[model samples]
Target: MRTTRNNNVAISCCSSSRNLVYKIKPLSHADSKRLLFKRIFGGEESCPSNLKEASTDILRKCGGLPLAINVTSSLLATRKTEQKWNEVRSRITSAEGIGSHMKHILSMSYFYLPLYLRSCLLYLTMFPEDYEVQKECLVHRWISEGFICGKDGEDLVELGDTYFYELVNRNLIEPVEVDYNGKASSCRVHDIMLDLLIDLSNGENFSSLLSNKANLARRIRRLSLMGNEDEGIIEQLDVSHARSLGVFRPTKQLPSLMKSDVLHVLDLSGCRGLENHHVRDIGRLVQLRYLNIHGTSINELPKKIGDLEYLETLYVDPGMIVLPESVSRLKRLTRLYVGTGTKLPDVIGNMENLQELRSINPFLQSTSFPEELGKLINLRKLGIHWRTSRSVGSSYKEKLVSSLCKLENFNLRTLNISFWLDEEDDFIRDFGFPRLNSVRTIRLWVGKFCWIAKCMLSHANLQDLGIMSGKIEQQDVETAGSISTLAEFGVFPACEGPVTITSRGFQQLQEFRFTWFNGLMFEAGAMPNLKELALTIPMYMLNYSESCFDFGIQHLASLATIHVQIDCRAVKAADVAALVCVLKSMAVAHPNRPALKMRTICEEDMLPDE
Candidate 1:
């Protein structure tokens, strides 16, 4: 016996002794309707009398296929009336095309969506199959493509998120990751849905997918080239009308963009064949708005890049790329992201529209660099990388702190600063961290934990805090726990020594993570509201006494999960087994023990002698 499984079909190929072949049948009509009704009404036992006839007809038209039934049900969930259901049934029965069995069912769902939603759904086809789309990236693209327009008092990012959730609610896309606040962070489309979208996109000339460049559309608006180099095919196409161009997995050098005068979004982020020469004429594409060359080989941005009057976003990978001073000419630029060591023109402060600037290496010889950064009044998110060697004199430190003080008046909400300083250097004393009202998220990678204590007291609205420091004292932990508004907190390995949490701390924290800590002692009633706890500690440091287990974890009444990673280089297998047994017993004894997940990582060979 042999079996084959395709998108909506499962077939069993078999040859009988009588020399006859037989094909397996699909789901029976009764079974299909049962599944469809369960999904449409959210597992309700029976359908209403008024909709019974409509449901039966809809299921019969779906042909007893699971994918068809689910897609049909998603569409029906929106249109509650019997008349609307009958209308959808009629359309599904009449849709014509290859693979009509599945295509028609999906097409009915697409056509029934609102006009604005249709464009948003079609835009998803540009991404590769099984790609996990980041919520921010997708929303930004939608806004750039003119698909998202906020109404009165609505922020554009919030509005875009609404559109994304709407698609998920309609069962068109699958949600991959949701944050602690129950907000989706990433999503993906089903393979069958992608196929239908590709077909519809090509048919309408709404977008083009170039694999070999055959059957090129006369006037394509959006073009996505996949697979290896096919310069011959790329050169033959007329790209003057293309508004967006993307090249994926290019094996050889890419063609120039001189002919594509009307391009708006150009993304060649991971193309290995990208070179400086290919983008020499990029300045001529004056209509460009979004450009991403993240993982390419280009070493320098042409001086003519300043010619793009309407460009809003510029993203490039980190390297020694020499950005021309003319970049300050882009008055409309909103987001500028570059590598760690990339040099910025002194006139960067002239780009008044900049909102997000990441990873500025502040080691330049110019003393006025920090002053220029202070002039970005519109900046919302700022990331700076500082090294001890750059701190030549007190003058640099004074200027840096002065610039940060000016930023406090702006609308900055997120701040990430990483420091590589010697053990003797005091981060908190040298840099007088300014207090900001709008800042809510703070991430620090410095040696001083004292600075964090000051920030916690300063930023009352702060919700997320991440600290990677050395020797976090008991007072520092107490300070973090005292923040009534904190929801998520993470302390990485750089932190040394044991930390104790007293009773009645962390009133609102839901998630807590501790890595490479010496020990953790929780007084009863500590972290009363924490839902998730993760600990990564070396096995040698754990004091597996009965009292330790008795007072440590059993007190976390609200914990739903305890994930423990134990490093087992210094302990024997028997000792590890004994520890696991004790932990299991403790969990079984607690009132609200929560689910326990533990893993052991062997750092040395511990096998018995042969």
Candidate 2:
């Protein structure tokens, strides 16, 4: 048992049973300084000149353990004076020691955290070991549990964002994914940090993990049931006062839902065997504010869902088809996320507090849907998937575009428009798209934008784009590259022609993909900031009698990864085999030694004509 003195935790991490050999390797000198200085001052160059000597001394004592480095650097980030830095360094008793010394440093970092931040950090213990925590989900849970309090005019959610960043900044958690907007989308607690937090959490009985461990907390405020083994331990405890509940795996034992009158969060996401009956009593918890059934086997939400009047966020799987019309009565609901083809009840006008309405395929919904959406002045982000077996006519498209313009006027930050399948109609150009001044990310999942692509370049705030054209011309390339803020761009050309890329455009592009490969060539100065490139084309393009195509990828100075896709339909087996070898050789010759990945696909058993 992993035990600590004072407030004892019930967590059983049987050290003797789980003993496994680990080859602990120390960081090299350069890497250690990079980690330390980057954490403290963004980079070594930015670190204070006067404190450089003290920083080095502290790093030496850390002895290359990342935990030690992070804690020491975080503790000294606010103290810029050399005296304070040296005094802190002098207090370090390790002197090149690594064992218990690392724990001592961690303890200081934990204690140094502001009281509120310490609670936030400790709350992370609710997540299972090695679980990747979503920032939005965690923050919302924190809000539901009353952990965040802001000034009278301040937004609590935004305040919660600051708290999230603080934990990340302090290195108590590691960022797993950072979006183009530069916010960490998800994070995970480090093992050392998790161990420490788990102990603290159990001591306070702030939350409990229902595991196979012998010692169990009878009363708990928050609880997580990770596996089936924990199911047997459920009836042994009481969760009447629990405010948050996270169910990880499928279980017949869903404890105390009827008794948890104050429960604010019910997350059955990824819980495989969850069925309709399991959540039938969910609405009884009138104080509930957040519900996440994503990836669960549940097919429908109980009609009692509307009884939970305080619910603010409702997330369900796209596969769950039945959306109770009574949901329109949820006046406090701010975010509603459903999958494609899941037509929301037309009562959207009732949700005045709605800030994000995900995923309405207007083609499948009533004509009044977009009109209802336009009135939502609070809607800041919209996710749309346009899907249809037959065309939905001009009226549908016109309403969508008009609503988008209205939403933009209300300051929509993100407009994510994806297609069930790529649409080729240049309909957007027929009825021009007016200025979208406030949208920061506009992803046109490549429906033959043709001439319309030029208009989007005018939006100075666009940082990422996925556009498709019937024919990618040099002029289009010039227009797109002119957007100084553009970082990720992908263009799928319907027609095959050489689109010679010149250095004149795309100065800020970091990731680029061009699906039309015929005559595609990269001039030496093209896409200087490009770190990844993906090229997709037919296998026949490489079957020239004289030679295979040369894409000129070597010109990309900063290229770090290369992905190629070959359409193998109706191609000779010999040709496919030869082109595979040729592409390998081409990747090997690149100066940057970028990692290469290739995909070959065919519907008819690969159509190997030979």
Candidate 3:
């Protein structure tokens, strides 16, 4: 059973078993002050003498809540003075009750934000609790909503990223995952902070959250419905002034957008019931800047979509059958994302404002597809999926390579090229890929291992490379190792074969992963700087003779951790024990022994012999 104490807190217990309940009480005043001081200064001993007296006053009014104390500390970390601390202390003490204290503390933090950051933080309240916000998606939304401020000579996306980090630093939001480049890839709002944001948003009329009909505001600018409970209420309200509208959950049908003429954003992502008829009038929303219909059941886009000349971002699900050529009329479209297998329009080149275009299914015979792609000079990130067949002529391959060569001056940072080749097709042998020097990350899903070697030779500055569904050979491994800047490498081979690594390979590689490889042999001085290694192989491969199982992992001087996943369905208990013993012995005998972790995955039904 579960019950809500306050809207911010929930208590749960097992009713079928012994009813043992656990509750969390507020922190003590002394403990709260200690935490606040340590959080701000990184140590209590470093707390300034002048701020100690003011810190006590602040902690006393925090209602002994850790969230309040932490948010206050984050605010004070920036303003380092006795006067500033006293001001915050006075504001906290003036609050009346527990709820009032939290609101006051959070409001203080919110009010202290720069104007640009305030809108960005408030917009986050539009999302549901515990929602993992993707940094790129959020930044694009901010840009489309006019929340991001532009700096001369700086990209708008980069400026929006700075705003995101500022909110994270202020303790307004928590980071979920950071990328390898130390950039926040996703984030979430704390429950306490979310409560504060809801209140603040309502009071300021920044946005309206409708869970039921009664929660709908009469005069709202932005609206997000929690579920289908109050979906009908949308038609009853006068949403002519609504600038943004979102449906967080699936409903039977979407309310007509005929009245929302001044709308800026219409996000119906993941609404399974969305039909083409529901969006038939979407073209009337000429002012719409951002539109997302991903994961919906709409098979084809309404031709009227091109009427949205101001549309900057368009995201559609992969199930979409065709994109209307009218989309070329959206001159302001900067970021276009479609799911896999989406046939793109021929006028893609006219949208010169596109900075990111992904998952485009291009027909090799369609000369317009590649030619228009080459004209997107502003494109920074590009992803293409090509379905290759034996019938594809040599002229088509040359045209594809020539079109890609025109993009060399675009300075693209990320490139993903995947080829779904027919079983009998040997496209990898004759494919000529132009050199893209600016690409930092290159992902190739091809049929042959030689393609990986070609990519490594072409892009010496690649920091990360992922090869999938390819045949890896010894020379291919040698080619990958010689890349001076390669740091991370992952390969999912198509065939089971032995891979041998000679000395002095993978000099700068830090992480290596081999998925479904039959066997791996590392000679001395190979992968000397490798820090993390993961091997996912079948259990039958581990039953080889002891001499064939010499992994030479001890040669990895900088190795720190190794993870092994064994597919265990036909594996015998004794064979598993023997393999575990060998790994344990290697870990113990190595001069720089790495931590070893192993797990078994049941891939199939157990055999009768087992």
Candidate 4:
């Protein structure tokens, strides 16, 4: 049904003839005469009346409107607007191509940005291109340097998102094509943008600050000096000419910055042997923008640390024995990474410009977390690692956990937790990682039967989860089900569950494997969606089920691959036959799934029957 404004007429066009459909609204006999006059006189109105009559006769020969109506200027304006809209649409379409939108966004800062912004942008060149820059990760970085402004009442994660959008609108970063959920799937940078980063890294004109030997400096823009334990270790190098210097070392001495006053970046990760001599001269580079001392041994920071007010990133290792009161004077610092054994003063959080933070213990656990930590509204990633030993279970542990709950929603891609448990099933109750929905991978070490495996399995965003060592008891396994709801890709330590997986439950499970499980024959609905399956047979159950016939698994219709270690010596041929039958049935059901190779181990091969 179509509605018309002329009178209050509603037309049911579905039943009408297709030929008259195009002539519905604008067609009319009088309108045709007006169109002719307008085309002939060109709106000049100089045509004669006699000539107009002749034109009308010619128009009558052409197709005429179904009804007569007067011409109006409103219709003409509508058509012109439509034409301009079409042109604008075409230009937008031409500017985009396959994956170009996201690629261009990754390096948006390289194009048409101020020099200061570009200088900051080039610092990201250290990471892999197209790497997802979490809003929290960037904010934390800004906070460590005192670059970001702190607000009285701002959500940390929201602030990070706002910053990211601002950069995107400036065409310094491209927005990724995401799903309705707003998760970034992929991104890339334009070639021209990357070239600009390269130029910034190399410095505009002067030589870069790389050294051939120690104690000598050369003119350079971006300088990375390294010390290695290899036989040809270069102990000393001069970087007087470089503007940014990052050092990775296996030696003791820190390189002297000869002539450069504007050192923007300085990283000395794994420099365990660095001494006071290395940091004494650091104050000379006042323009430093980023500084990392991740794995160094210098215990005490000199009072001159305050001189580098422009520092943006600072990493201190456990080897940094003590932080001076002057450390709080570096108001410009935004991002800071602290290793274990180093104490961070409460005043560190007082710096309103601070954003990103990564701190590991020896420091955090040694002292109570200052309430001032909550004041850094600009903070993005507040990475902290603390000791979790067996005897340390208490309410204090719960406090440590609840304090971090608010920080869970931040965009973090990787999280690593290292803990030791002396008691059974005690740690899981206190462990909390609910807010890490954006983390792609997690590496955790906890005691077996901690009871948190269920929670870990249910995590919605985890693509990779590694548990160094743990066990799942049969009862706990039954409680947790077969974990068929897990994503297509997952890895974990061995699991134990006497409960069998039903066909429906296994339908979505793609990869499955475990070590040290009970010797229970998997019946027909064990693993229907199994693309790959691996299992280890228990030694004690060999004699009990050895009498049962056919040792192979059956009924896994979707099984494309199988890896099993079976104790076939005590097993009868009937068991092997049963296994073969299942395999044959699967081959018949899914012809393309194909058969798998079988590998077996015999009890005779066991060591002295031990």
Candidate 5:
């Protein structure tokens, strides 16, 4: 049973089966001050000057407010005779800036935050700047790995939100200006706070000490050592310092540092000097969960590499690498990622617990798909990339599809099939994926355009469908019949796809996207239900090479969002005027779907759609 308290702001769950009861209370002024002081002073030696001043300034800033000044002063004296006036003044100025910027959040009452909550908040500092920290994504990651607590007693989403807000109130995270209903669209930690977090996480006891200073030992859990010319880690490590460690990087042969008792995640991608000795050293990190040796000089993983029984994720990037025959021994691995790897060992199908297989290389040359791949019923997301077209003759493509059909009953959500299929071959036959009814998103990269219209119509539950580069012919009249019903559709132009789409079958689509279509045009009244329309390539006039083709807004009456790409050099003001005029006419006619949001991306700003 769940009980609500504090006017429905707080919830407490009492469950006899789970033996759980939990309550979270708001912070009072005194409590806020106490926590601020505790956090600031505990790591004072390592904390930046601006942070210490920010902590002290919060106290005095609150004093100017109506409610906080009346609180008892017996807790800490107002040091009237401060000898370090210079430090105090400088800190006060910086703290004042922080206080000014976060006035609304700071005024909110604090809560009794748990240590784990603080740790989780601090860990975010390790990410690069201006990251969009999806609250749900973070919560799922934590819950999956046993980092969060109290899931049995309350809604995890609400608890996660509360902790996130608390962290924000404590001035640990700053939200980007964009918000959807007060939820952060993006977030970033102030650089000062990030430095503080890095210092704390990569403590002197745990971090791989690269310098003579042993102070950075225990604090580092995940180390990302980039670049080529780094000195050997043996001279840098102070092994007496480690407490918690996760990753070591730069793909180097750092055996002295690698021999640490705590290192868990290793990324040895792009290191040129790596050899068999490094692979042997990697086998010793039994607790290792992720190992990325992509782009390294090591061509083959040591046979003993499978000894790390706990490893769950591995990325061998751009190494043109191959695995030892013993890789089938890694029965616990859930994710196996190989980028630019030449061939996969035939024994990979022997591992039954494997859940994901991804390869990102255009140069992959494995001709036949392993029959054993069908054994991986637990696999959910599969991304295979291969260049060059071989029609349906490639048994590898058949095996890939056949393997997918075997996993028809699993809870598979995403399947990316990027294979070369010819126009005449039936890619989706009866032995086709019947169990893919659960699949909500599917991406197909058929080599020929004529295969698209037929391929788009087959999937049952596909809400999002992407078709990339094949010759698109307008011959199939019934093809448009399937597209009208799609909720979302994307097409990368082929040399011979539909030249003119004048059909009424596209009435039910909510989103319709086209990319690089040299000669494609939507017929009048084609997309009535379309809410969003994205055109990746500019519409140009056939006769005038320098002029742009214009689509008047009235043609897309139901579109609420329109995104188009235009060449700045080729576009004219009259073209924009024509577009606006078309939009104005559409707005005047359809009063309900007014204010069509239009955006144009030039070549300089355009990014390839994923």
Candidate 6:
């Protein structure tokens, strides 16, 4: 959709094309107004009275296009005075007859970007349009590609985040899944913005794309192959100069290492038909820094992996194969991700550069594993899946605990442990002995809540805690609330029901998520600082009645967002709708005027209205 010949139409195109059978119309005036104000002011009611008319006019000029609306609003978000906003509108309105008003808007946003930011923005075009790029993946790639750097004593990841948020502020990319940390875990590029980026990237030979629909020019310094294109395309394109290659859903048409001698990144995360032979020669690419085959069919990693001396991040998916012993030689590897049930060689301790090791089943490792783990003096984040089904020697347990304590004394910032056992053990209860003040987030899940939680609550720096408890007593809840630094808390002490939270607890808690929403009640003064509440309920457990909604949620002094997910299996649509209405009414009645979002977990065999 384009602006009408009269220059009255405000929209460019929707985020994606669906070719719907039914006609789709542009947003209405009211909808446009809300979208514009929401982006700039967070809500329509928050828009300044002085800027109301200007904002509406700007939105009208946007012609109900979300892309245009976002860019316009983002531009205005920084402009505090009336003059700057009107000047922007004048610039937008002046382009009415010259060319695409939308392109002018997007171009203004792009050209305003600094030279360094521009390259990073163009890098996003390598991803298929509408792809949601994980923030961690993108930031790391940006660092590896030399798109961003840090000064002395500055964290590169944090510096890269500033660039990410800047683009988000300029509406070049859309941030997604903003969690309790107030950081976007991932982001999406609008199709409109992507189109501009592709053109710019191709014009400068910045990167190349390989797909059925498009291909960049011959000098491919960075190449991205998307979709299962005919294998012949790989032979047709020249990848000799390529430094980075992202094979997204590729059909095993990977370029030979002989062609890519200086490759820094080889991301075949979800490629199809990617076999062990394809990655066997990874060591030959001595310049490689990031290798991701996380979801590929490649099961056996070649022994040559340890030869990549400069590799910083290695991601693999292995099934019942022994990791190459030589991996310990890659002293530069900082992050390692392995599949479940994947075994690591006893030499893990030799890879001291490792900072993040995840999903490692500590129970399946040898006695030397703990000694090796303790050697990772730089380890910042660790994830362990301890299944009680596996038998472990007492010596191994002692070593594991000693290793964890060693990490606590050092730089372990996040500890995540998941335990699944049919029977309880005192060992799991005593996992946390001394306080880990350096840790900011800790998630421990045992079959049942243990008294160890009281010890965890005593940590000085802990801010986020999530745990699973089988039968949590009222005292456990009280003990949890005693943490002064706690910000977000979640507990699934299921198998027990109908717990009441009085105002005496959670005075500093801001976000609370509970699995069994049906099992909790809120008193008048409960969780005074709480702002966000997410509840997941299983509907078959109880019959719907007027009293079912009497959880006294409105009493939370600062409540602002309520998210309710109802399992609709065998539940009636009318009941779901009825629940939504009551929640909306409650939100409307709250002093903070919180917003309510309702979702049905399962909609199978939904009963009709009676």
TM-score of each model, paired residue for residue: 0.80, 0.79, 0.83, 0.47, 0.60, 0.85
Please list the Cα RMSD from the true structure of every candidate, rounded to 1 decimal place. 5.7, 6.5, 4.8, 19.7, 15.4, 5.1
Score candidate 6 by TM-score against the native. 0.85
Best-matching candidate per TM-score = 6
Give the residue spans of candidate 6 off by over 4 A.
Answer: 1-66, 69-93, 96-99, 211-216, 250-252, 318-321, 386-391, 421-424, 607-610
lDDT of 5: 0.52
Compared with the true structure, model 5 gives a TM-score of: 0.60
- After superposing candidate 2 on the true structure, give the runs of residues whose Cα lies further than 4 Å from its correct spot: 1-22, 27-57, 90-99, 152-159, 178-183, 212-215, 228-230, 235-237, 388-400, 420-429, 438-460, 467-485, 491-495, 514-520, 531-554, 557-610
The predicted structure with the larger TM-score, 3 or 5, is 3
Question: What's the lDDT for residue 489 in model 2?
Answer: 85
- Compared with the true structure, what per-residue lDDT tens digits does model 2 show for residues 212-323? 2422535677888888454556765667788888987777667857788888888888887877888888878889998998888777888888888999888898787658
lDDT of 6 by residue, 1-610 (tens): 3433332232234344433223446688899888888877889888878887677777777777777878877788888588988887777763563226677788777876788999899889778877889988888788778888788746677788899988877888888977655668899997767777877877788788765244444577888877756677677767767879998775766877765678888899887588888887777888888888877888887888888898988888755356778888999888888765878888898888788888788877766888889999988888777664436655677778788889878878777656554454556565544565655666656565554564576568778777765677667777778887888888765645567888777788989988764456888889888988988777766677657777888789888788888888788888877777877888888888987878787787687767
Residue 493 in model 4: lDDT? 51
Clashing pairs in 1: 318-339
What lDDT does each candidate get? 0.74, 0.75, 0.76, 0.50, 0.52, 0.76
Clashes per model (N, Cα, C within 3 A): 1, 2, 0, 44, 34, 2
Q: Which one wins by lDDT: 2 or 3?
A: 3
Q: Which ten residues in a row have the lowest lDDT in candidate 6?
A: 3-12
Rank ordering of all candidates by TM-score, starting from the highest: 6, 3, 1, 2, 5, 4
Higher-TM-score candidate of 2 and 5: 2
Q: Which ten residues in a row have the lowest lDDT in candidate 3?
A: 10-19
lDDT tens digits, residue span 1-610, model 3: 4554453333224544333454668998768877987889988789989999988778777878887887888899988899998888777656667777687889889998888898899998778888888888788888878898676746898899889888887878898755333457889998778888887787788888765333464577887876745545666766678888887787656556787888898888888888888888889997899888898877777889999989999999888867898998888998899876676777788999888888776663256676788888888887877666566666666666676667766646676776565555554444445567655665667556664455456764777777777576766777777888888888777444678877766888888988754667788888887887877767664554555556788787888777888777676666667777887787878787787888877845434444
Q: Estimate the overall C-alpha local distance difference test score of candidate 3.
A: 0.76
Which structure is stronger by TM-score: 3 or 6?
A: 6
Question: In model 3, which regions exceed 4 Å deviation?
Answer: 1-12, 16-19, 24-49, 52-66, 94-100, 212-217, 421-431, 471-475, 494-610
